[model samples]
Target chain A: MSTATFYDQVRTAVTNRVPVALATVVRGTSLGAKVLILPDEVQGRIGDDALTGQITLDARSLLRDERSETRPYELNGEPIEIFIESFPPPPLLVIFGAVHVAQPLSRLGKQLGFRVVVTDARSPLATAERFPDADEIIVAWPDDALTQIDIAPTTFIAILTHDPKFDEPALSGALTTEARYIGAVGSRKTNEDRRERLRAAGVDEAHLERLHAPIGLNIGGETPEEMAISILAEMIAVRHGRPGGQLSNAEGSIRGQVTSPVG
Target chain B: MNEWLPEIDQWRARGDQVALATVVKVEGSAPRPVGARMAVSSSGELAGSVSGGCVETDVFTAAQEVLASNEPKLLRYGITDEMAWDVGLACGGTIEVFVEPLSEPPGEKDRAR
Candidate 1:
């Protein structure tokens, strides 16, 4: 395929939030040949048919984890190197409330490459002017708003609305999805009360366990911005499957563990 | 690479010969992850970066050669302890970057149209 066409496919997939992978032959014969792999289709070619088949399988596996790496493959007894680069859609940050904390949280989330969306029942409060950095501002009830969004494993839900009217429904809606991180803003007593109310509402203990109540790392944050920072920190920790504690106290390297190469 | 698409497209529109360098393999510590790209134009203009400024100059020079020869090359950079002290990687690591000329020069597309 032409380079223009290859770029067009990539641009469309990325803009439309589709998961895709681009495999490039980095070494051996036909270096620089590329194959673009989508969920349902494969575009372009990476030279040899046998090599392409093997790379496609590897690309699909790497796409699941949104990883990019180089792997060695034997094509007709000759070893070749292919770089499989997975391009997952940007992570989603759905803020349930458009409160003061939501403002900074949305901004911080955007800065960190998340597609931030702020939803609230109050139309005036969920205005675009209030959340300039947010990719979307929906003026709808929590459950209804969430129904319109595709919450997957890369989604982060933050229920910042302290009011039971909004927070309860928000938490309930968030629990139904496969969101990776779900945090609710409230005090310790408030969290306990919210948990009791959720239990009364038929939310099981297992689902309640997913909630990060009294949200954020205990950084003694008082202002809205500071609270926003704390909340984002906790969300990041949860996303990386890490305990929100001092890094200095950790024994291993600060960086994440690297994945071993696949033969 | 996706982040640098807009600029790369602009360069293509301008009909400038361009070369793309992508980090294919990284050993040990790496500033940027695999799939990171750096695009260089014939005019020496550049966008994005494969390294955190430690190896861009060398990559840019190599990119120029790829553009001139119309050939692709895989370049490797291994930062040593002394090099790390001058450059800013916390630890020494090796990175392999593949540089290739674009399939079509930017101006050629416009001419074809």
Candidate 2:
């Protein structure tokens, strides 16, 4: 394919938030050749039949991991390197409650490249002015707003309403989705009472285990902004399957693998 | 690259030759992650960055060469390379950049037509 056509496809996929991968031959034979891998079809070609097939398989695996890297292959005493890059859609951070803490959380989420959506039943509270950094401000009930949004594996839900009316529904609705992190903000005593209510309402123990109650790392945060940082830190830790501990205490490299969330 | 799409598109629309330099591979304590990109227009305009203000100048020069030659070039930068040290990639990391021309060379446009 021509370079213009190849880039056009990339622009379309990226603008629409579709997951796509591009494989380019950076070294050895047929340098500069590219293959664009989409969910349903493959475009362009890397090289000859055998080499192209191998690159396609590797690119597909990297796409699954949402990773980008270069791999070297030895062919007939020649060293070939292909760079496979995956462009996954930005992760979503849904805040269910336009509380004071949500303001900072939404801002931080946007800075981290998340599509922040702040939703609340109170129309006055969930305004664009309040959450200038939020990508969306939906003035609707938690369940209603969440049901409309596509909650994929890259989605994170933060329920900040300490009130049972909104928190219970928000937790229940968020648990049904494939959100990577589902954190509920409340006190330890409040969480126990909330858990009992959820259990009485038929939320199973297995599902209850998925919830991060009294959310965020124990950073001893007192103010709303500090609380936002604590919550976001925990969300990042859960996303990477880390225990939210200090790097000095943690083993292995500073850059760790992003394990798929069991939640 | 994704963030610089509009700027790159404007450069293309204005008929200026464009080259894309991407960090395809990185090791050790690299400043930027893989897939970080730097775009260079033939008019000397630059967009985005692949490193923490360390190697962009050299990458821009390399990108101009790619735009002129219309051939992809693989460049390596690390502490092992004296130029990298001079350029201030002091993070003790190795990065491999793939520079490719996004527009056809001026000579090729006539031949294709």
Evaluate model 1 with DockQ and give the value. 0.41
**Per-residue alpha-carbon lDDT of model 2 for A1-263, expressed as tens digits?**
75656777887887678888888888898788889988888888765678767877887888777777788975556898888888788888999999999999999888776889999999989999999999888888878887778899999899998789988998987887788989999899999999999999999888899999899998998899999999998988877777887878866555545442110
DockQ (Cα-based) per candidate? 0.41, 0.34
Please identify model 1 stretches exceeding 4 Å from their true place. Answer: A220-223, A257-263, B1-6, B13-15, B80-90, B102-113
- Work out the TM-score per prediction: 0.87, 0.84
> How would the docking of model 2 be graded?
acceptable
> Lowest summed lDDT over 10 consecutive residues: which window, candidate 1 chain A?
A254-263
- lDDT (Cα, tens digit) per residue for candidate 2, span B10-101: 88777787898898888777777788888999899999888888889989999988988888899888876556437746777888889998
lDDT of 1 at A162: 87
Number of the top-ranking candidate, with TM-score as the measure: 1
Score candidate 2 by TM-score against the native.
Answer: 0.84
